[model samples]
Target chain A: MKSRKTTAWIALCASTLLAGPALAESHGMALSGDLRIISDMSNPAPRAVMEGMVADFGEMHPDLNIELTIVDREAWKTQIRNALGANPPDVVNWYAANRMLPYVNAGLFADVSDLWEEPAFEALASTKGAMTINDAQWGVPYTYYQWGIYYRKDIFDELGLSEPTTWEEEKANCQAILDSGRKCYTIGTKFLWTAGGWFDYINSRTNGYDFHMQLARGEIPWTDDRVRQTFANWRELIDMGAFIDDHQTYSWQEALPFMVNGEAASYLMGNFAVAAMRDGGLTDDQLDFYQFPKIAEVDYAEDAPTDTFHIASGAQNMDAAKEFLRFVVSTENQTKINAGDALGQLPVNANAEIGDDKFLQQGFDMLSNNASGGIMQFFDRDFPAEMASFGMEGLQEFMVFPDNLDDILARLEDARQRIYK
Target chain B: MFPTPIEKRSRAAQLSYQSLLPLALILWLLPLLAVANFSIKPESDFVNGNYWGLPSSFDLFANYGRVFFESNMPRYLLNSLLITIPTVIGAVALSAMAGFALGVYRFKGNLLIFFMFIAGNFVPFQILMVPVRDLTIDMNLYDTKTGLILFHIAFQTGFCTLFMRNFIRALPFPLIEAARVEGVAEWKIFWYVVLPLMKPALAALAVLIFTFIWNDYFWAVVLTQGPDAQPVTAGITEFNSQFRAAYHLMSAGSIVAALPPVAMFFLMQKHFIAGLTLGAVK
Candidate 1:
């Protein structure tokens, strides 16, 4: 009888728990984010930085209650679109530039242009181009990192080679590395975006920055003469066998072993690859950085991906959400988040000090260099999702069969017409 | 016994069968063993590319401790328990009644109702995501453990009813007839007579539901968000940070997540085996 009564009570309690309101009953402003700025789950530094910023924002508006939800990063990439639908959160963490353009067209994000009118907005002055779409500013960028050619420093020293500044000089360096019995570039194109990095460089260099950005924004056709020239430059590298053999079999991470094993001399990738290389036991002295070699008579334009946060179109607490955005882009908060477990990204705020860390310093010199035609937020972030997917698939196919360039370009043009509409 | 119990075979045949048993078990368990090995080794071993070698240092404590203490795993585990136990009880309760009604009643459309439940089990789950999500939102249950649990119970009833209806049909009919001659009411006949005989099936189905709901990752992510509603399987993904995936911690998380189902299996091993083989022999 006692056991039966216990079972009955347990069932009742279970039912009540399932039907009860969620942990916090008080309704508040909701801000959803992609979690984990670092690989370690035990690392509290990243959360401390974000929460510290949030607490300060809370203090300024005591009447408003705010709740933040940070989901896993990959899941967030898929679910952020859902956040824009019915039952929308007050604000969402997102990316800047052409990535935000389509959703802007859909009217999913609120117009924060008035936020730009506020004084002391000089912090993210350089990222203004990326943050703006259709002549109106959309979101505020908090953190972003640089992408460039991370090469074998020891090999360069041994062969007496310097950083390649032009296309011709880059070819000569590739030739030199080849003659020494090592390949120059090793990439994994199974997921396809890896090859898009090389395409971003070749296109930006061959046709200059304006045309390249226009191409990503779908203002130029895929089969345009400038696009053809970009492919021609990429084919030149492929014909010379500058990249590793059968790269389609490896992931971006898997290709790093070749660089570590000394079989490949360089990798065109993001700054995140540095920590992984260090994990593989490659010393700082062994690995070094340089911009992608210039291909045409164009100013250097680099791929520096930036992450941003925006107010949802149908948000309930608009004023509180705007206040949260204001705090996130502040020079102090940006500096704190960057200095915390988010160890890699350069703060969007110009005043945020680039610590004496050798990487941030080298990256700062390359990016802030006057020769830079300013930042392109990488291929995936700079193109609409549909067009980016089709382009990445085409890029992977081209990597495997460089001879099928015309067919690939024609197919991409067909997709572009349909997707842009 | 079926297949003449191998013991009646020649000595050589018996010896070969005994030898092959361990070999096949090892083949089946190899990947699981590798995951187990990974759960114990430090991240340095993987960094050094010592995948197949002995660990330089055992991190059995540190890895699991971090997964529990330093991560949102404890809360996630609690969320899973709250979501699953109720779902198992609710699904089994509903399915048992529906199965009994379909098996014993002479009602019209009985076959159609049973077929409808059976047909639902065959439809792909991915197709239900969008409409179901919208419905949950409309009901104000989206992003809650209650939403996930309720949806799990609804969908899982399809398979559970199929299992139960077939199991109920396989039982002897004269037992119910005997009880009816004694003027027992229909509901009493069900509660007293049929239910007492359903012990093996109930035990098997409860264990099966426990395993299914506990290991679920997709619906946990789809209908729920954050530590307040997500289960351990979804919580395991928190280790995959921005650029790099932490395989060592992920492996540790996976092992911890896999334990409840393994324990449930071992605890119900007898009833589970008996239920599976009941129809097979007859």
Candidate 2:
């Protein structure tokens, strides 16, 4: 019955959208003046997507002068504050969740709760909590990608093992892989955030999503018994020699060779790793995906780091800025921009069709149907900046020296008190 | 002699020296050779962890073609030229006048003024980064070629002035005295006599400053950004995308960015060597 209602509603939306000129007039036909946008989609493929969106949006509202500036993606992090504190552009790119907290509090991001009230935004319900702060929405997510374990199918087949579904099965599979003279997982903690991925999965699976987010919010101490349980769970695999040796020396890209060369059977990485694995000559027949298995019977809580667009609080062209954002989240625009040959990621709008790639399809299915607990914005984006830095460092040390757990937890507990204070 | 040449050593020692010299030379040049090798490799080779292995396929034309035709490298190279040429001229000209005044006039506090020029070189430029950036922003010159050129000229002038002054002091004094005795104006004595005599100093300083400004990555990053104003040194990082570093493309871009200063060195080899020692002894 719910599926039928969704189909009928989607049909209604399609009819109105297809009705053409009269509907378009109400949508955004009157937008004019210069609508400036600063995007951090500076990579070649995403750069084209941003420019294409600007061109199409300009064509739709011919009277509106749309200006687009693309900044280098990494440099934009430091420069965003300067851009927002002064004569800000109409729209700018940023991340979702706690990453937006500083700008929201500084009054740099405009409140867009009214936009969320519209029936059209229902398609983006999954990410609404991430976009909201203090009971109001600050931005809209455009794209996000899922995180999971990408394993070598041939290795699993040779060992007569299947994708693990629980903590017990996972360890048993790891032992089998070790017996076969391969590490169960390959990870690089050199830059320190890759270890945070392991923590996010283990912590979320060990104690449900609510407890994990509470920990992220610094409501719970790192010395909490529940938190130790998460570590104890992780320590099992570390103690079993389940991960590659000297992983602290490699970058995330450098860690890819282990899985590609069959020294490691799998990698617990984001969907982006599939491209690198493929570049390393791992064909689809050899590579496959599986969700991180159940622990403590908690529902699946997936990491899908979202990239968003927010209207500047000091926008000169408010109406046009809001309209352009609306245009950005429109089903057609999201579908085109996040297509396989474009940004090559999942669209935020549930109604938008996913790309035809096998990994993208599996990721979409897993996130849409299986991720009932929650969608986390990864470790770094979910936590405060200072805390995430300290947390990742501690996590890397813990991965390297499991015996240092006591000292690490105490230091983190101290950081939590200070940071959240 | 306390120490002898390689030929004066025993046979065993000479043999080791002959063999180890080529080994050391190869070791020293290995990194440069690796960069050249990487610049011609396919992008997939990096992903495949073939970093030190023979490239799976030669992609010299494709990679370099992308750097030249598809990327913003040409514009960045042009920006470097625009910034470097003006800075070299400005620094050399200002220092020539300042060097002439301090070297010839014997005015009050002339030695004090020369000491001040030498003192400016003692400052570590890294300490000036924040203040210099703020100054440019306040002057409304942030991210402009003029701002970079101005800063480069101001900062480089100190060393240039020191070099020019010492070189000018090394010149025979009677030539200037004779020019003065002919009732020629002081300015004419500078223009016709001292200036022509300072040609080698000017060439050495110009080549030195040109390379210095062209290769400056730290200030280039601090003072400017984007293709409109940034020099090739900082702009080479444009090859890194959000997730992955394009090592192949960056290697190609680095080679391209390095060519101008290298070409200047080769073309002005005499001036470069002379510039290194011109003011050191005298």
Candidate 3:
């Protein structure tokens, strides 16, 4: 009996050892050392999902060790800078384009051009032009979400209203919502820059695409008449009692309650807000999406920019990291990411199928139809970090004290000059 | 033959004063109450604009469990304790020794060094960010708990020394002189005589350092990146990004993160107040 037990134990140990490396090979390429992926997803939904993904990744690569640290967005940025300054992680999730430009210029991210040639990435590369920079691909595109107005469909139905197709129609709808004793819009500017999303979309719709890009690039002054006109339109809406009171004191999350309670008719937000809307007890039947409405008579193109992930140039496991990138952008994973309600992001791989999510399908269909002529990077991601900070602060000032547009624009222009110089 | 009896106040005045106490206490505790209320509220309560009102449902246990089980909060709390405890001990011990030297002995550069500590403690953290990070890296201490604790001890020593020095300066010199006259060894004098009298100061310094280090967000971010070293404050912030609009959960997490120091303060209130008021008397 003792001899039989010893033989069984030995066989068990041998089996375990044999299974480990096979598991490691399944999750793309295995790394000899530990891997760390840092993100800013500390909330329950995304955190739970990410933890599962990390576990799955670990199971598939038994030889590789994985560590995930979610820091606050602000602290994450600061920590990433400090970490890159010291020793870069094996793989990191960071922004692409100008946001990635500084880190790329600093030689902090691995150049994943070879992975871009792989069939999985090739499909994504053809679909997402923004992820490619200067003929070199930097990162994998895992999630792409559209930003627009999320309105209460139930309230619109109750009030006999329809989605507006024009700027004038949107204003009239907002006015009617207000006339019915409800706030037409709910927004918060507590961190200051959140208001910039509204400003960006509105300005893009009003002044057309190229002008907005020019403003972001500093080729056009912030104090230009076109810029002032955007604020003017916003002020007109504010004067009609269209926005929530004390908005300057509230954050985006804080203002969400108003929309969910039917106290406010609409929220201008990203696809991320879908989870919040659900958490707020607003059913699928209660929510709907609409474009920001055409502010210009000219048929200008619409552009929607998205957040992308890249490996740091100083990555210790460049080859392994690229393999991981290829795995993430693969049609299989992108479909999984899109099908999940928590993520609900549009897959950048054109050939990848998105599951039956109504809102996601709407965003995908809109993009496919080329309803938006051109895509522009989100204001914060498009401009240099410092300039973006200044612009956000300016947006807060404009919202809180609309009469200070001249001073706000002047301050923004000064900030632009300093950063550009 | 004696003192006149004191007159009683009117019933209305007494009622007003009695009413004012709870009212004032409530006013003073409004912000904390708000956080506490928000912590137990269902996400729908906030979404339905029920903020500043009674919660529709209590979810304290659920939220609290989620904070620990769903995130790295327990790990963060453990990291915080590891970083904070050693820092408190090191800073207090080092400053106590240095404070004794400066306070008991009239040495050259004593005031200069004291003033330097005072000034260094006041400089903004941003100015020190680049150089300090580089120094941490070069020391091969980057991303370690020890690296963060070491820097925090070194940085906090400035303030701790100031506090300890002044505290020791106010101690009567006759005892030290008597010990010296009796030929008590210098080390013995410091250990047996001086340390015994430093209980209040030590208690004060310990609580203060505990709070400071526990609440530290900037250094936690700068010195660490992963759960292996990051603390609760940074952890909560990271949690915020994932939940986005889940304020109830965020508030619950914030309260959980904030409770330790708050409980510490309450338990050590006397020592903390005594330490804070050390220089205020003279």
Q: Judged by lDDT, which candidate is best?
A: 2
True-structure RMSD, every candidate: 10.5, 4.8, 7.7
Top of the candidates by TM-score: 2
Per-residue lDDT of candidate 3, residues B121-189 (tens digit): 899877888798789888988778999999999999999999889888888889999999999999899
Question: What's the ranking of the predictions by DockQ, best on top?
Answer: 2, 3, 1
List the pairs of residues colliding in candidate 2. Answer: none
Per-residue CA lDDT of model 1 for A1-421, tens digit only, reads: 9656544543343233222224112112222222111111122344455666656655544445567666555567766777687678877877888888767889988888877766545557767878888788988888777889999999999999999888999999999999899999989898889988999989999998889899987889999998998999988889899999999987887787788888999999998888788887788899899888778888888888887888888877665566567667766667777873555567877776666566676776676654357689888888888899999999988988998989999999999999887
Each candidate's DockQ:
0.16, 0.50, 0.38
Candidates by lDDT, descending order: 2, 1, 3
Q: Residue A326 deviation, candidate 3, in Å? A: 2.0
What's the lDDT for residue B80 in model 1? 89
lDDT of 3 by residue, A238-304 (tens): 7788888899988788889889878899988877787778877889999999867888764433335
Provide the TM-score for each candidate, comma-separated: 0.87, 0.93, 0.80
To one decimal place, how large is model 2's interface RMSD in Å? Answer: 1.8
Per-model chain B TM-scores are 0.93, 0.92, 0.86
Q: What share of the true interface contacts does each candidate keep?
A: 0.15, 0.34, 0.61
lDDT of 1 by residue, B154-238 (tens): 9999999998898889889898889899899989988999898898899999999999999898888788866778898987877
Candidate 2 residue A346 C-alpha distance from true site, Å: 1.2
